[model samples]
Target: MKYDWILFDADETLFHFDALKGMQLMFERKGVNFTEQDFHQYQQVNKPLWVDYQNGNITAEELKHIRFIGWAEKLGTTTAELNTAFLEAMADICTLLPGAKELMDALNGKAKLGIITNGFTELQAIRLERTGMTHYFDQVVISEEVGVAKPDAGIFLHAMERMGNPSKERVLMVGDNPHSDILGGLNFGIETCWLNVHQHERPEGINAHYEVQSLHELRSILLA
Candidate 1:
C-alpha cells in the first residue's frame, strides 16, 4: 500500500446499515408492524437530527434520544430503551458490504487500519466483534466518544493522534459520504478515497484523491 495508514468510515463504507429494515425488525419484536410510511415519518425527525448531529450542534446522547421521542411516547417506552433496542436490531442484521472482507484480508499488514465513524459507540464494538473484524483494526474512533462528529476536524485529529501521529501525506481516508468523509479528510490534510457505490455525482465542492465503485477496485488500485 502507498499510504502508511488507511482509515475507514464504518457505516455504508464497510457495513450495511439499513436503518429502515433494522427499524422494521425492531418494531416486529415489539409487535408493531413498521411500514415504509412509518419509516418515512421516522426519517422526517431522524434526518434533521443527523444533520444537527453531524454539525456538532447536538451531542450524541441528544441525537440518540431526540429522534425516537415520538416513537417512545407512542410505544409507552423510554427513549433509552427504544434506542438500545434499535441498536440491537441493527446489530442483528449487520453484515459486511461486498468486497469488504476481501479488501480487509488483502490489506492486512500492508498498512495500519483504523475506523473513524459517526455511528454510536454501542454498535461499533459489537458489530466489529460479530463480523470477526475486530483484529484487523489498530484504532476505532467513535464520534460519540470523541464528542464531535465528522465534517469537524476534531474527530480526525483524535483519529490521527490514536494512529500514532503519522505523516499526513502517508494517510488515506476512505468513506462513502462525500461531505463528511471526503471533505473532512481533505480539511485534515490527508488523502481521501470515496466509495461511490451508488454512482452518484460528486458534489461540486468536494474532491477526493481517489474514487472507486467497489472495494475490489480499491484493493486493486492499492495493491497494483
Candidate 2:
C-alpha cells in the first residue's frame, strides 16, 4: 500500500542523545558540576516521571517542576538552580541524529512529513530549530503541547488530523520507542516502523509493520 504521510519520533529517531551527552560533558567541564552519578540519577528520575506524565498521571507543569526538584534533591542543589542549568545545558546541546538532514531532504516533497514527539514542546522546538530540521515537517505535534502523550491513540489521531485525516493504512509512524510510537500507531490503525538503531529486541505485544536501522531505510520503505 502507498502511504501519504510519514510521521517521525524526535528524540532518538531524528535527534541523537549522544550529541546531548557530549554537550552535557562540556557543561560539566565548565563547572556546572554534575558528576556521572548525578547525571545517571537525574535520568533515572526523569524518565519514569515522563512516563507517568505520558500515562496521564501528572500535568506538564508538575512534571517539569518535579523533575528538577527531584534532581536537585539528589544532587544537593536548589530547584531553581537546577532548572536554570538544565535548560541552558539542554539548549546548548541537543543535536540531530546522523543523516537526519539528508533523509529529511530526500523525503521533503515525496510525501507529507510530520513530527509526533513525547517531549517538551519548547525544548523540542529549540532543538529542531537549532539543528535546522524544523522546516522539514509540515506539522510538529509534541505531547506537552497537546496535553496527551504517546502510547495513547489520541496523540497519533491528533497528528493524523493535522495531516488532514488521511486513510489510516496510508499513514506511516516511525519512532524508536516500541511502547510509545509503535504501539501508539498500532492503536491508531496506522502502519508503524520501529527505528531500532541500538539493536534492541522488539518488545512483546508491540508489532511494527516495518523495522529500520536508520533513516536512510525510510526512503526505500516509503517508495516500496
Provide backbone clash counts, one per model: 0, 0
- Model 1 Cα lDDT, one tens digit per residue, 1-224: 68999999999999999999999999999999999999999999999999999998999999889999999999999999999999999999999999999999999999999999999999999999999999999999999999999989999999988888999999999999999999999998999999999999999989999999999999999999
Q: What ranges in model 1 sit over 4 Å off?
A: none
List, residue by residue over 87-157, the lDDT tens digit for candidate 2: 65676777777778888887778778899988766567778788888788899998878888998888887
Off by over 4 Å in 2: 18-30, 70-81
In candidate 1, what residue range of length 10 has the lowest lDDT sum? 156-165
Task: Candidate 1: give the clashing pairs.
Answer: none
Clashing pairs in 2: none
**Winner by TM-score:** 1
